[model samples]
Target: MSSYSGNVETGGAPDVRNLPGLRITKLSVGPMDNNAYLLECLSNEDLLLIDAANEAPRLLELVGDRALSTVVTTHQHMDHWVALEEVVAATGARALAHPDDAEGLPISTSPVVDGDRIPIGDCELEVIHLVGHTPGSIALVYRDPKGTPHLFTGDSLFPGGVGNTHDDPEAFASLIGDIETKLFGALPDETWFYPGHGKDSTLGAERPSVPEWRARGW
Candidate 1:
């Protein structure tokens, strides 16, 4: 777990890769240049994307006829999901997310919840609740036998800041508390955070920033 998170800028495309057990790649999309990730966990062909938005052409180019498994979303934001139907059409993969986030999706689907685990090849993904950014937002934890745990957080948790919120002040605070109680402070120092909009970070790297974030009351 390292705090070496990358703060990517707008317009730049997401970096692509094929890692052990999980092939995670980031796609830059939307007006805000949100990041959408495409993953191939175990067995190399089943693709699971974290978020899909503006870069349909590039995303398709990346897929290039691979077998798609599913599209898992952290939460529903238009920039993170505008190209969903295209993703589904191209890959024949279903879109899944927390039930609270279903309302925010372009197409309708049943909401996902905490404690649900979905399997992809030999890997298993555990859904964790860290609902601060959005009432239905979720963080996905994927642990491989290699001992590195990956946390795919939507807008909930980030490297130095949490997701932006304007709905309920109490809920926003609650979300922050949840991240402390259940995420960076709660999980092992090595847990990796894969956020929806920015670069990758870890528990050790993101922990010290929490108090500062809370201090500003943002």
Candidate 2:
């Protein structure tokens, strides 16, 4: 994956994080700071809300009535897209997600697949398929002008860990293997990861821990 690091700020509804081709904003709402992101096109004001978890008022206050092109859900977990109805109602936006996760949520979603390009203003978001966390989990990858790649993992990988699994007994090991060999290991140390439920971590910082995770048979 490519690294797309820019300005990540706190406070206000629009916590702007600048990348080469885009500007990212974060909102920590609800019981957890689920890291709902706002990607506004630099060339245009087209907005994309990544994981509409909670704090509708706060998130709306951040976006402030901007017209939204779409809202993307990382998984079927309520915390990830619970606020989708509110967000869509507020902006008349279309909601999208993995086809497998369709029936569980409030709205119909366009199935996100590997290598799909999400257009945000002048920039493009390349889709990275991440499974096992759910049947159809995906990570968003983008490279900035500086060549730094940023990955939006959405509860798949964290600073010093892989992700949490509550499904099948074998899922833990399978997902961990995918993260270690496919997702985490293939990316650059410069890659920055923003998960669905915690603090952000860099690829460089989260790398060595992969082997330990494998040893534990997780």
Candidate 3:
């Protein structure tokens, strides 16, 4: 197994313990630097994987001795699920994704919609459907016992700007709107969001740039 560090070359494995009962492990894989996450609910050791982009062996090793309960695909993009089939087959975990992108997946997916609650041991992950990046790109929000929020965003909202809309005006508008209202407007500033690739960011850090992003029409 590769060493557990935040560096991608060393598997980008982070030392668990971002929140009280949440242990987050990140791995950067594939040529695109796709990020795959292992969310361990420490209370009962229940595990939920967000994106299975690549490197099945390393992902499996990250699971260690715990049974992987669910694997949630953030979107239907091939880069985000390159290792989906192998990981699911190895773990026997149910695959969950939005219905819009479910058909693009190689394996059967238990469809998820907005306002759905996915249980992870004592914690519950609230599904927030955000469009524009993809027809069904979704984000998972988990509120710790102390009220701090943790978000798992696929390709929708990133650290700098919203996910690529391919330069379409409407798509860009929709994406920014969803993020502004659903994420920024609703969640607190301290919410830490983990995207499908690259570094994580908090609402407070990125909140000020919303208007600028909208004005630039990106």
Candidate 4:
């Protein structure tokens, strides 16, 4: 009964029924080309906007008149929340982020801790706190009804490698450990992940290189 055509970036119509009513729209915005995702639950018309990183106008347009249930900031980094305030103001959505990085965010955000459950209609996403990218960097995991799992790992995990540690030894160690245990060890290889920016990758593809990454000490 909903008429949302989605945005031009989504490319062709997403088969809602086949996808179990889960719709993911990725928009490249801001100076950093940060990816802003619109996760829409077609069954209940529940929308969760992830990382309002920029291009406020386009983000607003994608959101249209639908009420947004939550606006989630994956971390406290400035680039990730450039449009956070504006989008939240426009949509009246609750701003949610990890407590470790909440103070750094431009707007006040409700703290989401590890093991918290975020509901999207009948489905839900489990929060995994990935440190080192930031003290509060977190990833949201959604297990598809059909079996495959989906991960939204802000900047913590990405294709080819983990997020930049900026030469911080302690931070790098923490992030690598978390990625090894929480991400690679916990999730299945076929799990598909959408990062905060850039291309998507699967755990199956990146799992083999874990030793290489550790050897390089990056």
Candidate 5:
């Protein structure tokens, strides 16, 4: 089994997970404790960072001398992209986000819709647009040929339930519906997902609670 615990803390050491062709480094930063994931293709060492949450200095330190190719913001949340401008400016990496939330970001981002494929050297990530947390909130899926699929869910999903919808019944419905159909429905139980905050979980671990989440309507 993988040694990665998926546990990180603000100002703490990051946890690293190694896959067949990819290496994932998870670090927590900012006051909100947002998780930033660095996906490196083992073949070429090309890197793609999944959220420039905060603390540009720490992020840059983690990157070291490697070139960062792209920075994909999970959503438009201020806490999530607080370090986007700085990280992008420092690394000269291209910024990418869903078109619906692009305007909220500090820097201009190229739109990446559902089903769009992002390449990090030889490995690729498929974008899955999840509505509710934000109009363009997305999760990136990396299907490992040698292991189970890995999902990087922004605020759209978590261990216990879906992201907050500010108690809007309609928004909750849309978010839950999309998550059910697009995420839980399409992906297998073994798929392991890393959320924007907190620890990681597998679909199997959270699958049983889907009904409870829908009924409570939070």
Candidate 6:
């Protein structure tokens, strides 16, 4: 596998990671600098996109001539799906999102709850529902048999803290609590996590800050 920094800039080249059986491409788009991820199964070339964000043309170009199997929206936030309808229309890919945030999307989406597995050629991504960022925000977990786990956390988890809860203590508590138990508590320290925006981070790098994040209440 090549060294992937997971660093991307809007209108620039995407950072690609070649894993054992899958390839991950990360791109930054829109004014919000939302990060969109493309996962391709090496065996069959099955493609899955996480978050359309913006710049439909660029996302479509990223897919090239290949068909996109699915597009999974992490949350109901507007910035995350600005290109969703266009991309899905262009690729004829199935749209998937959590039920609570499904109505916020431009098009109809198949609801996926926690524990649901989304197939991508020979590999699959497991769903992990995380609340607070939105009524139904989710993360995707890809457990590579030959390597450590990978997570797509959307706006739920970031390098320094969880997603914004609008200063609502209740919401922040819920998000942090779920992240601690479901993410930090369950996944290994080596697990690499890609967020909806900005840079990527490993679980081990952020584990020690969980207490601080909770205390800060962001």
For model 4, what is the alpha-carbon lDDT of residue 55?
Answer: 76
* Model 5 C-alpha lDDT versus the unseen true structure: 0.96
Per-residue lDDT tens digits for candidate 4, residues 1-218, read 63433232322222121256688777778578688888888798888988998878888888898888898899988999999999999989999999999999998889899999988777788999999989999999988987689899999988888898888989989999999999999999999888887777899999999888877777
Candidate 2 lDDT tens digits, 1-218: 43433323334343457665678876666676577888888888888889888877777776785788888888888888778898888888888887877777888787777778888877777777677788677788876756788788988887767677774557777678778766767788988777776577788887877788767654
TM-score of 4: 0.91
| Overall lDDT per candidate, in order of appearance | 0.75, 0.76, 0.88, 0.84, 0.96, 0.96
> Could you tell me the TM-score of candidate 2?
0.88
lDDT string, candidate 3, 1-218, tens digits: 53334445334544454667777887888678888888888899999999998888888998887899999999999998888999999989999999999988989999999999998888889999998999999999998887589898889988899999999999999999999999999999999888888878899999999999999998
* Model 2: lDDT to the true structure: 0.76
How many clashes does each candidate structure show, in the order listed? 3, 14, 0, 0, 0, 0
Q: Would you list the clashing residue pairs of candidate 3?
A: none
Local accuracy of candidate 5 as per-residue lDDT tens digits, 26-72: 99997999999999999999999999999999999989999999999
Tens-digit per-residue lDDT, 1-218, candidate 6 = 48899999988899999999999999999788899999999999999999999999999999999989999999999999999999999999999999999999999999999999999999999999998888899999999999999999999999999999998888888899999999999999999999999999999999999998887778
The RMSD (Cα, Å) of candidate 6 is 0.7
* Candidate 6 clashing pairs, residues 3+ apart or interchain: none
- The weakest ten consecutive residues by lDDT in model 5 span 1-10
lDDT of 3: 0.88
* TM-score of every prediction relative to native: 0.88, 0.88, 0.93, 0.91, 0.99, 0.99
Given candidate 6, what's the lDDT at residue 213?
Answer: 89
Candidate 3 at 124: error in angstroms? 1.3
Residue 167 local lDDT, model 5: 91
RMSD of each: 2.8, 3.5, 3.0, 4.1, 0.7, 0.7
Candidate 4 wrong stretches, greater than 4 Å: 1-18
